[model samples]
Target: AQTVTQSQPEMSVQEAETVTLSCTYDTSENNYYLFWYKQPPSRQMILVIRQEAYKQQNATENRFSVNFQKAAKSFSLKISDSQLGDTAMYFCSEAGYRNSGNTPLVFGKGTRLSVIA
Candidate 1:
């Protein structure tokens, strides 16, 4: 069994500031995957970043990045130069068993991020 946990229930960041959300997971499979998804007001889940357990370097997007510590099973998301549009619910997820290519994500409750202008 695998479970994802987001310690922060909500967070706020002023425009152009930086914010980081905490996340952790428990899993027995070595080939599992971790992800951060953003849910906007439109109710769509957008992939923010992803880290493969096999990779030592964390994954990064344009303004979004992750601090994935495989040893401690921690995967956190960092939003640099946050904007108002970044206000949304962020969810951490984990999936996969072994050698499988794709699987459905098991997500945490979420962290509602509010970006004030």
Candidate 2:
């Protein structure tokens, strides 16, 4: 079984500033994928970044980056130069293989991020 946890329920950052959202997971599988997704007010799930359990390097996408600590089972997202568009609900998820097929992603409750001007 795999589970994702986001300790912060809500967070706010000033515009053009930086913010980091924390996530931790517990999975028995040796190989899995960790992800950070952003859902705006329009309710679209957007992939922020993804990290593979086997990869030693962290994943980055534009202004978004992840600090992946495999041993600690921690994956945190850092949003740089935060903008109004960054305000959304962020979810941490994990996916593992099952019987040669990818299992459905298990997601955290989500953290609401507000980029205040």
Q: Which candidate number would show the highest TM-score if scored against the true structure?
A: 2
Any residue pairs clashing in model 2, and if so which?
none
Cα lDDT tens digits, model 1, 1-117, are 888999999999999999999999998776888999999999999988888889999888999999999889899899999998999999999998645466678999999999999
Report the error of model 1 at residue 31, Å.
0.2
Model 2: lDDT equals 0.94
Off by over 4 Å in 2: none
* Per-residue lDDT over 1-117 for candidate 2, one digit per residue giving the tens place of the 0 to 100 score: 788999999999999999999999999887789999999999989988889889999999999999999889999999999999999999999999767899889999999999999
Output the TM-score of candidate 2.
0.96
- In order of appearance, the predictions have TM-scores of 0.94, 0.96
